[model samples]
Target chain A: MKIVLCVKQVPDTSDIKWTENNTIQREGLESIINPYDVYAFESALRLKNKYKNVNISALTMGPKQAEGMLRKLIAIGVDDAVLLSDKKFAGADTFATAKTIAAAIKSKLSDFDLIVCGQFAIDGDTAQTGPSIANFLDIPQVTYVKEVVGYEDGYLTVIRELDSGFEKVRVKLPALICVLQGEFEPVRARINGIIHSQQVEIPVYGIDDIGLSVEDAGLKGSPTYVNKAYRAPQKETECVFVESCEELAECIKKCGGICE
Target chain B: MSKGILVYSEITSDDYLHTVVFELANKAVELSKKMEDAPVMALVLTKPDLINEYKEAFQKSGFDKVFYVVDERFGTYRTDLFAKAAVQAVKQIDPEIMLVGATCQGRDLAPRISTALGTGLTADCTGLDILENGKFAATRPTFGGQLMATILCKKYPQMASVRPKVFKPSEVDVTRDTVFIKMSVDLDDYVPQIEVLEFTKKLVCDLNDLDSAKIIVAGGKGMKNAEGFALLKKLADKLGGCVGASRVAVEMGLAPQAVQIGQTGKTVSPKLYIACGISGALQHTIGMNSAEKIIAINTDKNAPIFDICDYGIVGDAFEIIPKLLEL
Candidate 1:
């Protein structure tokens, strides 16, 4: 069985600082593999470790700089890595994103049986890509997944997380599953694995390579656009001081606030 | 002619409408009154037998029209199928505005319907109002919960997904009545690519259910470590309350995500909310601002949490919590 894990290289949101021009200062801030995608990568690695016949492949779309993330995934135990890098793929939203990814998967149609991705990208938090990709592929999608029960001949049992609770779901082979963050802890990198990944060659695919027109890959294909981005005004509130134990008790009593 | 506002009524596991459904109903009525005697319409996907159980609740909550799709396949939420049915219904009924709760199901269904109808959708709105020209002005937090922005859709049947607990539900009117409209759809034509095989509930800690708790004791980054959280638990247990946390506390791994109270987390409205060692960022305060009474305990007297708090303690939470636990 061959598993394809969709990963992304995103700006570390925690470290993002704004410049005077209201744009993100990507300078000095390091880029890493999206945290949620790590869970998907770990899940794929676990499957490979359990089954000797299983092979895991890493796939991502971003600038050429994203090749570093793919290399890191290869270091962590993936067998092959592919980068969908091109200026035409810039500014694509979830819909266009799913299209490009589906096209990439189709190019390797013979060997792939399952596809996995993180539940959502932290930067967007839209949680639309996985389902949209499933729709494009015309396959069943299980989202907010916590664990995989087991895989049979052509069906896989899995557990999905709902707002109130969870339910057991089963989807056939050739399906998409989005794993939630912290679903499973990642494996520690070994010395041999790191050396092997450094020596491995990663293939890059552009617009023509994927058989997609430049118009269908990027800003032109995206339906939703961020018209403008600005910071929200902050609301002001007054702070009060409570000095002594007596003052604290009096404040609690006068305010009728929480206390035993 | 007065225009009617529609709400997509979502169902809970207990076979009742989710609380947000009635909240939206109350909001719809408010919006409808602005349109000269318009009525609020509720669209439910359920069986005929189930409709009877929810009809009175809808009427009591201010629904003037109860439009329903009664079918077995409608029991579970399927986005494409529901969107197809809802789009068809809206085209026939012709509502001026549509409101949906920003729950997981709503987040999935609203966009699909909006896209299919070629309308605009404003998601996770914190505020809503009718402009002078009678357009829906929706306000929502953006940029990782740092700012609030108001937006207007250029298209008709303006749709918005309201965050739950942002609005209050109206008092039930037992004397009220409603008009029930039963609608049917062919489920065989729509096939869902995603199938729900099974669901497993995560194990929630005993201290996590703070929303329903009468007393809620929450700690923040100021609590410092696990020992501080343990102290908070003792106080919560003594006060017969549950423990809650700020986003900082959750990020620090001192508490679980379920107990997080903030803009991105659960919005809680308990009777009494105790903030221990919390500085009270605006995002956290928005979630707990509706609580009946608030008591803030932090070492920094100038911490922002004191402003919204009904009571303030400028002492260390490490000292206050332990003393309170003994009492």
Candidate 2:
């Protein structure tokens, strides 16, 4: 089985800080492989363990600095890594990002059986990239996937988390699954693995290498534009609470006014 | 010439329309009223048998016209088939604005349809307004909900997928003369790639539907363990409300994903919200900040949750929760 997992390197959102201009301060914040993408990598590794002759390639689209993230994936046990980085691919939205990735998958690693991605990147929070990539690749996709049960005859059974309940879906081979952080625990990199990763040559794909026009690959191709970004105003209040539950219940009636 | 605003009537399999459909419809009606009272149309996709079952309800949904695709294959929610039908409808109607409920299915379908139509789509929007030029100004929380970004689409049929409960649904009336246009879609050409095997409902302790709950008792990472949420559930039961949790608690396995309130989870606006052990990150606060009243219980005095709450108690939830339960 051949698989390609799309990964992203994002600033650790929990430790993020904003500047006076409302721009993210990306300097001090440590950039790691998007936390959600690790679960996708883990899923592919599990499949590699289950099947014979399985190859997993981790791919990411970002700046030249993102090669460090690809190496991290290789260290964590990906068979190979590719960094789709170029100045032309900068400021791409989900649609343009998906377009570039689809082109990379076609040109670099064709005939892959599956594509796995994290449910959503914590930075963008769009959750649209995986589905858009699946659409660009003309493959079926299931998001919010909680579990990858197993592979059977020409189909993969997976559990999807929905709003009301869980649905067990069986998508044919050559499909994509957007994984969620569930039962799978991410594996750590070993000493030898880290050494081998640094030694592996990561190929960088530019827009010309991927056969994309300059106008179609980046900000120019994005249809939606961010007009403005502003801090959410803080709510004002004079908050009070009680020591005991009985007193708390009374406070709810007295202070809250609705807790009769 | 710019056409009127359009809505996708989101109906569940149980022959019920989702509350979000009406919420968007009401919002669309208001938007249209601002745009010289341009028609607010609804595109309803359902089985033939289910059309009459929901026709009058759709008529009262404040839409001036309803474009319905009634085919047997349309009975189930499949991305490829629905997107194709919807794209065809959008081409025929040429709506200036399209509103879809940001449910699981809508999130999947809207992007596919918008991409197919070569248009822009704003996802998971919390606010929608008409700009001076009549373009739909979609406002959504970005950067983990620390800031709100208002986006504008360069292409036509400016589309947005709005979260449920962002706006309240209007009351339904029986006498409204909402026009229904029956449409046909051929599904033979589009083959669905994914097959549904089985659907199982998860059994949790609370039957509370967080979307409409009047009172919500929510916990956070400070809840420590699953046992902490059990205490929240008890307090919620006493208040005749539901138990909600921050994304951290859901990620910590202290609560189910269904109960999580955050940028990635459900956006709720209850009458009274009692937050316990919640440090109130922007991601979690964005979902519940619309509540009419808020009360926070956290041991840390400087917890951000206190800044947003109407009333707050600086105490350990574990100690105070037990006392609140005695009543």
User: Best candidate per DockQ, number?
Assistant: 2
Stretches of candidate 2 off by over 4 Å are A241-244, A254-260, B171-176, B203-205
Q: What DockQ does candidate 2 score? A: 0.61
lDDT of model 1, residue A175:
84
Instruction: Report how closely model 1 matches the true complex, as a DockQ value.
Output: 0.26
Q: Residue by residue across A1-260, what tens digits does model 2's lDDT show? A: 88999999887777768898877777898888887898899988999989888899999999898988888888888989889999888888777888899899999988899999998888778788888888788788888888899998778889988877788988988988899878666588988879989899999999999888987788877778888878767777676645556666766775343332
> What are the per-residue Cα lDDT tens digits for candidate 1 across B41-85?
888887556888887788788888889988766677655566668
Best lDDT among the predictions, by candidate number: 2
Q: Superposing all C-alpha atoms, what RMSD in Å does each candidate have to the true structure?
A: 4.4, 2.1
